[model samples]
Target chain A: MALVFLVLFVAFLLVLLGRRKPALVVGLIGLLFAALMFRYHLTDQVRLSL
Target chain B: MQLLNAVAAMVLYSVVLGAFWFQFGDSELPCPLCLLIRIGMLATAFGLTLNAFWEPRPLHYGIALLGAVLGAAISLRQVALHVVPGTGSFGGAVFGFHLYTWALIVFSVMILAIGAVICFQRQFEAQQSPAPSLVRFAGRFVVILGLLLCLANVIAVTAECGVTGCPDNPTGYLIS
Candidate 1:
């Protein structure tokens, strides 16, 4: 999942260099990937801290 | 504004480099949460990259806002884990704060900064021209640099995690 973010971010840059719209698409993908990763981390690594 | 955006990107890249220094120099492999922080930070930086080179729009800054918010949440989670007595902490401390704590601070600043910047209506003027040559040059350099660093991160994570998920407490690269 983290790799997905990294790869999408790099793709964001790669597409970002030449175009804007596709780069935005890539950015959205990054956000989606981050969200999924965040969700997984929260649930899988759930720990009670006081 | 474009130049300033580029400078902001530079600051972010510097922080990532610092993380790299700790990962490679101090030989402390990043835990799972740590990698997420980097991902969030990079996503936020991506927004700045757009603002520096392309048209500065509310949408661009929105990306920064969302990234910061997400990053802040992750950082807070990490902080909570180590806040309790005897829970201990991950990695080493810099300037007396763990990296996750620093990440929280950085994300806080990014949220405020992005919120403040997005309010300037003049930046969204439809008649705006392309960025100056210097800004364009800087943008290209930053993007290229980011690509290289991100490639490095991909390789590093692969070596560290292998085919399985990353370990919670990583002391050495799994592939090694």
Candidate 2:
């Protein structure tokens, strides 16, 4: 979802400004957002493909 | 140098932004696979953004490479899905190719390009020293652009899918 990138972008910005710790935290949040998005997409659709 | 990497990411973001605009303009709805491709693009962009800001390292390039590989895989999967003789393609096609096909090409190119760029050890040294004003400006500009794009997608996706998750085949914005 866009939230994933939104979180990661903020994290990237944090690192650019010389904030490493916060960037890591934000990056993890982004990953979490991505995981949720993936779960939702897969579970909702539940398609089978080769 | 680092500026070029940032610019590369900028270009990638621009392409996705164009697609986002086209989606709204043409009333095309992105399916779940399409959404994954976008995420893959963002993941790759994230790695490149890191390289642009910090000192260029093999690890950073590795991150970018990983994202590209995964994205390419997803793109390929979608292409396979619609490649059947009778099955129709998703949304719309651009220049006779679906967006997934383009995504595969972009990620493939990014993989090669990153490898070529990583071979140059000189650029890595450039970032250790104080970056020039232009590089700094470019870095800020690219990140700001990314922020804005993310904001737009977040709002747009929310309006499109709401909290229930995106539909397999979306037709229009859903707020209920």
Candidate 3:
């Protein structure tokens, strides 16, 4: 998940260097990925606790 | 405004360095989520450093906002993991607060700072034209620090996590 965030952030940076709108779009996508990762993490924690 | 970005970048780098201190000096490998938070900090610092080099834009602040929000969420989750009455907190206390608690405070402050940037957009714009001489000098330092921290993170993560990736609860470096 950390690697995923790093890749997405790098992509966001690259896209940002070229275009604004696209960069924003990429950032939103990154946010979605983060949300998904967090959800998975939370679920895993729950399973562990159970 | 640019000065603000430079200073913010420096401060973020210091926090990351503190994380590195724990990782290398203390031989405590960070959990996967902790690493994610560190990456988030780097991303935020990178955005601020970028803003220091160029005119402040909504996009730059937007990136920082995303990083802070993501990092805060992860930190909050880490805090939640130990919130139960009987469970002991992870890691040793730093200044009477756990590292994750410090992260939450830092992220909260970062959110407010980003909000300030949004609120004072006009001020940032007004100051952009001349591109203060101080920014020219400080910007380089921010860039160097940002890169150094990023490199250190990459090296440390690779050493600990390896190609297989980090364990959920990392105990130490996994370099075999």
Docking class of 2: acceptable
First chain TM-score for all predictions: 0.60, 0.80, 0.61
Model 3 earns a TM-score of: 0.82
Candidate 1 versus truth, CA RMSD in Å, comes to: 2.2
Residues B51-133, model 3: lDDT tens digits: 77665787788788888888898998888888888998777679999888999999999999888777874745555256667
- The alpha-carbon lDDT assigned to residue B100 of candidate 3 equals 89
Task: Give me the runs in candidate 1 sitting further than 4 Å from their true place.
Answer: A44-50, B127-129
For chain B alone, what TM-score does every candidate structure achieve against the true structure?
0.95, 0.91, 0.92
C-alpha lDDT of all candidate models, in order: 0.80, 0.74, 0.72
Calculate candidate 1's fnat.
Answer: 0.34
Better of 1 and 2 by DockQ: 1
Q: What tens-digit string does per-residue lDDT give for candidate 3 at A1-50? A: 54554555554355335454554565556566656666666655354445
The sequence of per-residue lDDT tens digits that candidate 2 reaches over residues A1-50 is 55665676687678667786676567556655665665565553435656
**Top model by DockQ, which number?**
1
TM-score of chain B of 1: 0.95
Q: At residue B43, what lDDT does model 3 achieve?
A: 67
Ranking by TM-score: 1, 2, 3
lDDT of 3 at A24: 50
Model 2 chain B weakest lDDT span, ten residues long: B122-131
